[model samples]
Target chain A: MDVALDTLKFIDLTTANIIFLFIVGFIGGLVSGFIGSGGAFVLTPGMMSLGVPGTVAVASNMCHKFPKALVGAIKRFRYGQVDIKLGLVMAASAGVGVQVGIKLQNFILDKWGQSGSNLYVSLSFVAVLVIVGGYVFYDAMTADKSGKPEAVAPLALRLQKIELWPMMTFKTAGVRISMWFTVPVGFATGMLAATIAVGGFIGVPGMIYVIGASGLVASATELVIAFAMGLGGTINWAMHGMVDIRLTVIILAGSLLGVQLGAIGTTIVKESLIKFVMGSIMLIVAVSRALAVPKYLAELGLLDVAPGTVAIMDKASFLIMCGALLMGAVIILGSMYKARKAHARQEQEAFGQA
Target chain B: MAHEMTKKQAVVRMIGFGAASAAVFGGIFLFANPLTEIFSRGGMYAALPIATVFLVSYVHGGFASNLWTALGITAKQPAKTLRPTATKRPEVRATLNA
Candidate 1:
């Protein structure tokens, strides 16, 4: 397939297209603000669906993401959810992880070209989502059964016990662990993020189980890591003239709105709800990526699949990705509504007392 | 309670956001021809997208923040039940040192 590089001409964008990008950006932003990492997964494909080249879509999305993450981190900071120190530490190490991830990605690209690289990414997505999502779901269920609020994992507790040198304490996250443990987890998260673009699945769980951060703090901190990674990636892509600014700005428009609302919604919900939503999205996203595996396998001739079947599978993959975002939106909106009502009732009670 | 901005304040924010967004959109439109031409210049062409992203993040980012405030969707104080401390922690001894 001849990939036309000239397809990225700016005049191709229309007013209607700009409006659509803005709306999508807002929604993507809202989801990220709440969940810490999501908008890129949706925005990149969303732009591609509108005829933007794949690389251009990804590049433009990356360009818009860092600033949006910056905005989100600031807002969540005001809500007292962010651990700037932890986030910065994680980001620093995650940068190295991203370099490693890119090196691995380039190696894969060298060997397999585009299809093989896609296969590797989809497979990793499936593997990580299933393993991590299942564990989170099972944990959430067990916590519910025990009638205990979902607490930090025992692994985190045990890790904290290891009195290694440089016992850094994340006061906001309420954990004291060795910098050794924290750095590795942050690096791994960055590596996975560079590969699949959604590092939160690994980063959040890693923080909870390995580093002992609360779900809220872990998720919020992921935004900072995301900011660092996105900024770095954007500069790399921009150097290639691959970024479509119009597309990026449009997505930013929507995402910014979505992210702020998502951040605010965090104030009203229970910690377990975060786990539940994260688990649910991860599982669904796993299935979505799983749908793409066969197509890649077919391309590699590892399997004999029909072309029509491949096309259908590709569409299914896109739908499942959208489904993941929709599921996330539903959870955030539902929880926010409940929280808002509860807040109003509390205010009314205070008024009555007065 | 929702912060009820006086009519003047509301108008000012509205106009501010509106003008900024318009200017951004207008800038993109006005430069559409030249920007596209420069972007395709290739080689050291990386700066075009980098600079554009920074510009968008600033202009559009401000709009998104103000837009959220206008929508009555703002962060509330942490609940009394989950009032974790927001204090910064002191640095711990390095593992090798300890």
Candidate 2:
């Protein structure tokens, strides 16, 4: 599955590639700005489909991502959704987590070669998506059932009580907890990100459930963590001459627009909707990753699946991946539309009052 | 209210972003061979991507921001009803003491 850089011949940007890049970039940015961890999931595969090598795809994606994340963080900051103190603390710990994650990744790569590495990544993706996404979905549903938004988990409340050393306060996130608690959660998110490319799966929930940040702040803060991780990851991959600038530029062009729109959409919606959207994307993405696992297992000879079965699984995986993005876009757009209508109604009411 | 950008501000942002993006593209196009040669130099190759990431973040990031504002998409003010409170929750006292 690993496409070697030496074998990759640079191709001129075709019109299709250009158009696709812009569209995906916008959508990916929208998802990222909304959920804080979706652009890479789409952009990496999107570029790979265009004859870009895997490393180049990853590198280019990272190259585009940092700036996008930076812009997103700034925009969200203006809306007062970002908790800089908390974001910086988590980001610092996550940096170390990335180093450990890379070492583990290299170890897997050395032991199983490319297929094994792919299997490891895919399995981790499925596992994290299932557990985290499932919990989020279940929580969202139960909250809806109760006719009240889901409260922070009991586990997070207990964790917050420990009063460990170097206690920090995030006023915006409305949490005052020890730095010790945040480190492990941030580290795990980074580790998962190193493996799966979507750290927000862990990062957002970790902040919400573990650190007790509201969904809005948690999602916005993830951008800060993402920027740090992407900056580091880009440098690492670029050194190997793996970054394709054309790919980076193309994706950036679209994501910027999408991210800004996403950030603005947040202001119009209720806080709970953020959780709803995040949980939805996480669950569907879990399904998408789960679909890919059988194919990986088949490659490892762990399962004696048929060729057509493998083909179906591969298609299913890609479809589900696209489904995750589509589902996210639907939620954001639908919520934005509803909010706009409500806003218009309020404006009319105010005019009547005047 | 969405602040309408004056023509001068719009022109300045556009030119700044345009020049940076062009320089990046030009650097890649004209110096492809030399850049690749230096970047693939193993240990030092790390700097190339790092530098480029920063460069792209500044240029492309700026372009994206300005482009969005130019199109009238901007962050909205916080809803008045959702204001934060400085008072600690009473639940914190019981839980923290325990």
Candidate 3:
């Protein structure tokens, strides 16, 4: 009975640690709510730093994510944003992609050891985030400047014309594309999720540019994918006795509140703001992960650096990651407040006219 | 169409669910040690934690939704019109590529 409990390093829940987890969970959930996929990237690391083992942190984080996602997806679904068929199809393939990703990860870990594995993950994070994040950020800026509605990418239009067999239509997403086209996007999403713990970074953009879903639909549908992935992952982890329920519930308590607020935000802002927020966070996180590259390199004997310097870089990287989350939350709340005020004023003027 | 909830009804439901959520969380903390052991025991016991979160999410998620509504932080009116409507289409069956 106690055998599984004895091996894992579960932290004692002090008042301070609980407060920290709650605050981090809230902000992380807020971002996840707005963009469809986030929270775990910060939550897992935040827990690990609190002395919870890596696997336990991951398991507990997954445990919270699905329910959080279920709530968010439902809330967004009411807003007419979620596309269930699209989400289910992508999730089906994402499930397979996860298995492939895990096998690849095990191979890397075995060949290169911890430091090597860490280096590979960090490098991949930097590469994917910069290339994709940059394009997204640039797109957001240009669209905002032009003051034009979001145009479907030409790539999506071309793919839609392919006349591939078994074509499917996603009503909510307002796209008719080959089911074959969706498989790779979902697979890449799962692969990235297994590697970086935030597949939305790829999944959301993939849906927008490739599958031709609007940003709103893409982000909302992502919640469905997250829910499926989170549930599947939690069940697997639980079988190994890896989930720490205490940590899971405490985070859930805060995230549940934050996610509802985030769902409301989608209604208040323009759809392009979703891209702006997602892109901004991605770019910042890429820099933070990049900083950790040197430390991992030093550990693998590929680079020489003072222990103090490596330690400094590690701390800086974590702080920057936290800052990125905080920045995202601030932008979301501020925009929500401003939009609400303007909306109220408009309503007041109209009432006076009546 | 579903009947719209009055402001008064929103307040009553928010308080009810909030109290229930707090009580559940408090009870868990009260019996923290033994609960943690049983919940993390792997195998059949894994269901305990999964079920617990599902239960908590229902209670807490309900409270959170009502809390926002009571505070007048609800979504904009005519939310259905905010996004584009999906076009009517014929259903397609799943096919595997050779």
Instruction: Specify the highest-TM-score model's number.
Output: 3
Model 3, A38-84: lDDT tens digits are 88878888899988999889999999999999999999998888999
Tens digits of per-residue lDDT for model 1, B1-98: 33645545644675687687778767875666566556645557867766666676666666666665666655656421222322234567768745
Task: Please list the C-alpha lDDT of all candidates, in the order they appear.
Answer: 0.77, 0.76, 0.88
- Model 3: fraction of the reference interface contacts it also forms: 0.48
> Per-residue lDDT of A234-343 in model 2, one digit per residue for the tens?
77777666766656666776787788789888887666777777788877877877777777787778888888988887778777787788788888989888877777
Higher-scoring candidate on lDDT, 1 or 2 = 1
Q: Which of candidates 1 and 2 is the stronger one according to TM-score?
A: 1
Q: What is the TM-score of chain B in candidate 1?
A: 0.57
TM-score of each: 0.87, 0.85, 0.94
Candidate 1, A240-314: lDDT as tens digits: 777766566667767777887888777777666677778888899899889999998988989999999989988
- Give the per-residue lDDT digits (tens) of candidate 2, residues B1-98: 24656656766796789688778867764655455445544466767655765676677667766765665554445521222422243353434545
Model 2 residue A30 lDDT score: 90
TM-score of chain B of each: 0.57, 0.62, 0.77
Ten-residue stretch with the least lDDT total in model 2 chain A: A1-10
DockQ for the candidate 3 complex?
Answer: 0.38
For candidate 3, the per-residue lDDT at A315 reads: 86
Evaluation by DockQ, superior candidate among 2 and 3? 3
lDDT of 1 at A182: 94
> Clashes in candidate 3: how many?
0
